[model samples]
Target: MAYTSLYRRYRPDTFRDVIGQEHIVRTLVNQIKSGNIGHAYLFTGTRGTGKTSVAKIFSRAVNCLHPVDGSPCGKCEVCLELALSGNFDILEIDAASNNSVDQIRELTDKINFPPTIGRYKVYIVDEVHMLSKSAHNALLKTLEEPPEHAIFILATTEVHAIPATILSRCLRFDFRLVPTSAIAARIRFIFDEIGVEYEEQAVNMIAAAGQGSVRDALSIADMCVSFCAGNVTYDGVMEVLGTSDPVKLVGFVGNILSGNVDEALKTVAEMCDSGKSMAILASDVAALLRNAIYVKTCETAAEILSLPEEQCAALRALGEKHSVQKMLSVLKTMTATEGEFRYSTQHRILFESAVISAATEAPAAGTTAKERELEQKIAQLERKVQALAKPGFKSAPAKEDAVQVWARVASELQKKGAAFIALAATEAEVESDGGVFRVKVGSSSCMKILTDKSNRDLLNEAFSSVCGQKLVIEEVKKLDEDKSLPYITSMFGKYLEIK
Candidate 1:
């Protein structure tokens, strides 16, 4: 016998064998049992979620001379006849290749003909969204009023592309992604039937790599069966997936979370030397961090993750040692690197940079960690001052000097939670002119902050509180000569004589 791929060989032939779409199955089963089948049906979902498979099964069930619980009895004459490859009752159309108006017209023209061996002539159109606009228009009329003996089943991954007219006329059933646990169990059953020796962790790993697609998971299992020569191990599955060993990944991420840049880089170099793709490495590291977070927070982490006991224990231990924020930060960096890899040729360099950035707690552009720390400290001090300077307290006497009054205004601004404005005010020169406070700032950045409407309002309120009277505040640009040596010497007088 010729060889067959695992996915194709294990494809579900009946509704009972389908997984992870019980809602759709139940409704369809009830429809079949109640003899309430619709003329037009739409099955929509991601690829490998069994939309097409279920469509085929539903077609057979409707035409079956004997249906056992809404599924076709394969032994019946109608079911056996429809099972043939050349069955005239069931027609499978690939809209991707025949997506023309003429093709759709031809299909519609054939709608008048009844089924050769069954009650309904079922038309299964895969990738129906690929049809052009005119093709959709051509099919719309027939779909709206098809013959009683005709059943139309349209399957598409992108249902948004389908016309609303077609959607409104059809009974739409959304197929959901199969759960990881269900896929894992299916893999175990297949492995046992195929006589393949495997580790439980290996099955879970393959199922997870499927990302909720049964066909994708089985395809991966096929590759694993071939590569492992009938014995699938966890490490073998990791190699097939181009992912790092769980132990090594745990250690590598541990180094990163602990801010050990040197050790983390060494681990990266080692993985690169082993021929691991940098993109996959980043993805695997991110997945590990996400799993660790789940393990730490979720009560049903082991069940949700579907990880083996040993790996779960290791992840639990790792999660206990690191904070979720730190892990999420690193995971964000890794995810960004994965996206950047598509645009850059230097994957290794990008991955290493991300690792270093995550490890070192890289500050924002043009700002050092020390500067951020100082800003934070200033904010804390401002909060403490505001808490101490509550209402109903006696106000301090108004100062006479312009500089002293400006200092009091700045203090008042800090109490009002304008710390940045207060800091900028320290670098500005203030003067009293006609009972108005004139502020002169040399730096354009400082001027920008003081001139903002909200900040200006804050300054006005602060000046009123400090000066014991409401005053109009005006922003003024300092003269160039104000920075000259002569001007400075005159302002300082004999207290600071020029050399």
Candidate 2:
């Protein structure tokens, strides 16, 4: 016999054999047993969730000559023929390929004839929503009232794409995505049956990576088995998935929470060099941050995370080191950067920038270790500056001939149309510390003129020449409430000028 894939080889033979979707399987089995089967059945769900598989089993049960309770007796001639030779009455059509009106019309005409061997003529149309509008309309009347010997089973991943008229006549059954635990159990059973040795963490990783799809889980497991060559390990799965190592990712998080920017950036660059896709890396970073946030708020460990025990223990330690607010902020940055990466030409640049930017964002509202370090540094710097000053030199340093200096600087600045002077003082106070000068602009209109970089540079150079010190000039933002009346008076003054 030819080799068959694991999913097909282990396909559910009966309702009892089905994993997950117990409610749906039970309802279907009971309907078949009670002879309450509908003319048209619509099965909808995500891909690889067993919609079509259940449809096939239901069709066989309904047509089996020697049925066993609610299931088909696989030994029966009708069931065996249908399963092996593909019975004429039990027709399976791919609506995606034969979606034209002509094909549907031919199918509708064929439905008028009775079953050749089975009790009912069953038409299983997979991906039924792919049918064109005309094709759907052509089948609508037939679907609403088909022959007594005919049954239509429509299966689709997208139910909304099918018209309401076509959907109204059918009994809809929604198949859910198999849960992680259920999928993992099935995989574990299969691995054991195949005599494959695998790590528990590897199975759990594959299950979670599947995202609630049994087929996806199986596909990933298959890849792991082949790559490991008998021993399915978590490291093998990670290598195949090209995902950042959980250990390295946790270490990266620790470095970040400890405010080790250099180490964090280095790790990020290393990940990029390892050919890890930025999008996947960002997703992993976001997941790690989310777990940290959960741990910080919930104060629960091991029991909360569904991963292997060792991984959960490491995440719990990280949760203690980082605040919930900080983790949430990091998650937001990663998520936002993931969106930008869609059209980004320089994803590495974008990812690096996002990481650096996240490092500078505010932490939780409480005091943190990073804040304590900054405060300590600021205090030390303040003491150093205090020590540098002469003892008891508290009085304001001698006001240099600032009045004379400003007059000269003011003349130089005036040449550049900055006709302004300090408002607080006639001259500036200068010493080894720095220069402090106040400008008096009799008219607020000249604020922009004095603030211009060119004029500011001229004044600074003129002052430095006279006072022998380098200085920085800062412009104060005048309060709106303090200047609102002046603007009102200016408007009236403009009116006077016009008059």
- Per-model C-alpha RMSD: 24.3, 25.7
Models 1 onward score TM values of 0.65, 0.64
- Alpha-carbon local distance difference test for all models: 0.75, 0.66
Error of 1 at 465 (Å): 39
Off by over 4 Å in 2: 1-3, 99-109, 262-266, 269-279, 290-323, 336-353, 367-499
lDDT of 2 by residue, 6-78 (tens): 7876788787777778888888888887888889999988777888888888989999887786888898888
Q: Give the TM-score of candidate 2.
A: 0.64
Off by over 4 Å in 1: 99-109, 260-266, 290-320, 332-357, 360-499
Candidate 1 backbone overlaps, count: 0
TM value for model 1: 0.65
lDDT score at residue 493, model 2, on the 0-100 scale: 23
